[model samples]
Target: MTSPRFVIIGAGLAGAKTAESLRAKGFNGQVTIVGDEEQLPYERPPLSKDYLVGNAARDSLYVHDAEWYSDQRVELRTGIRATRIDRTSRRVELSDGAGLGYDKLLLATGASPRLLPDTAGVHYLRRIEDSDRLKRLFTTAASLIVVGGGWIGLEAAAAARQAGLAATVVEALELPLLPALGRDVATVFADLHRQHGVDLRLGIQVEHVGNDGQGTRVRLADGSVLEADAVVAGIGAVPNTGLAEACGLRVDNGVVVDANLRTSDPDIFAAGDVASVYHPLLGRHLRVEHWASALKQPAAAAASMLDKDEAYDELPYFYTDQYDLGMEFLGTIDGHDRVVFRGDLPGREFIAFWLKNNRVRAGMNVNIWDVTGPIKALIRAGRPVHPDRLADPGIPLDQVATA
Candidate 1:
């Protein structure tokens, strides 16, 4: 039997890992990867943290070097955008006037930063080039005005602090990271920046941004104006689902997919931030921007394509380094009303567990040593931990699940 041709849209983690999973499953079919970026699939998590701090090199951020793709026999079509998806003919049209035929398709187009059009002085930190340009600004600028209190914004603020630049962050929301994190956990970040000398302005919106040769002026809705050498934006992201929507695929919140990660059209599948996959545990479709979700979902989609039945049931985990502190979030946080913490808050370390009905549903750890196995077990076994034992650092967090 001839191996089927597989065309994957997006060369990010989802598209790249799907190809790797295909070869790992012993399917030797034609795999062509289409991406708009010039570089091959590389890790994005570090782009705002270590990469932005100038600690990690560009080559190191790549999951696989040139050798891995060559060995896996994956054809890379970088610097090409999939303009249209002809589900009727099972082909994708590229901007460069090339069309690729496929028996199966995977949409991993991912997400793009929310950037204001033609904004004179503000920049968004989304890709390598975006950070590279920001880094240049970092070297010359004396002060930085960051808009938004999201992860990207907070992370950049941390980087700006590390660079010894006078950094000021303006968040429209009441608290930084209030959308994703509960107030209790968000406070940790709010404190982290303030303690590090970040001029945090919360509950403020940018009314107008005007720039001159000397610096940029950011006028706030609260009748205040702040000037700085440059402005960096850390507003969230919007899923790149336009092509999928144009293809007549259902795109409610994102590219809707069943529990099996199959799109409305069975021949075409979608994953990553662009995919709104049904979560059986959550009892609804969820779009997780976490790295683990992006890495795990595409494997299930590929397995389903190769006639392997696997329900992508792994937990989600994402880690971020803000200055010298390391923070990690695991499991699902929805429907969690109660949270219990492990370790002291003043000792510059702690872990917050999101509990629903006395069982751990999600968690966030700050500076806790070797917490991976414990967080996974807490989610897996539905562990119920005591509040007192959790608050004591001597209690060894990894053993909490067993205790």
Candidate 2:
């Protein structure tokens, strides 16, 4: 009998990691990775930060060198797109007219940046080419306009400030990160950027944009205009669920998966931003687009594929760095009513906990490193914590979880 074959789509971190995990889990079958990008699978987090700032080199962005893939006996079909998944034949049809059969398949086709109607000098940062273009544009550009006040947009604005360019951010919401952090916490970011010389315009919408000889003109809804050398729209991202949806898989919110990250078809699985798995903590399907989820989900996916009874049940975690503030946030803040702070918010060093009925539901530590474990413990305990003790730095978080 021929050895079982495993095929993975979308050679980003999740796909690459799934291949590595399959070997670690002792699946030792024929493994093939298909990706649309010409380059090898690389990390995306640095593209907006270190890579954009010129502190990191291109080669460092790759998850693993070419030798690692060859050493692991993994076939890499880069620069090729997986056009269709033939469920009846258990094969994936490639754009090059080749069909690869797979006993088990994993789809990790990541998301693409949400775009706006095109105008000259407009940019969207998602791939290596996007960052490279911004690098060249930043060299000579004196002013930049950033659309959308989310993490991506703010990070880009921070990079522009670091580049000594005048950065102005336009956000339609009242405050940046309002959807995720709520107004109270989001205001902190608004102040942080303003203090760093970022001209943050809130509660405004961009009606239209056009490029002319002077520069790029961004027209506002209230009959105002802003000019800049270049404009970047970092509104959000939409998952690449075309292949999964086309194959007749359930795609509510995202490709719906159970606790095991298996799609509607038993032989197929998905992990990453594209797969909306049932979250134990949230009591519903939650689709996270953070780097931590992409890094961690593949292990569970590989294990489940091998019938190991593994489940992706860990709470979500993500981090960011802007100017001098570095933060690690654990868990979601949905249904959270009150926020309790430990340490000094004015000093920009503290841990904030979101409480739902006095139970710690989520926590964020800013400029306070190495307490993620304790924070997660408090959240997972699901016990009511005294607001005073939670607000007091004198009490360690682990003790608070128990007390």
Best by TM-score: 2
List the candidate 1 regions with Cα displacement exceeding 4 Å: 383-385, 392-403
lDDT of 2 by residue, 49-168 (tens): 989989899999999999999999999999999999999999999999899999999999989988877646689988999998998888999999999999989999999999999999
* lDDT: worst 10-residue window of model 1: 394-403
Per-residue lDDT of candidate 1, residues 78-132 (tens digit): 9999999888888899999999998999999999888754378778887889889
How well does each candidate superpose onto the true structure, as a TM-score? 0.94, 0.98
What are the clashing pairs of model 2? none
Q: Which pairs clash (backbone N, Cα, C closer than 3 Å) in model 1? A: none
C-alpha lDDT of residue 246 in model 2: 97
Query: Would you list the C-alpha lDDT of every candidate in the order shown?
Result: 0.85, 0.92
Error of 2 at 251 (Å): 0.2
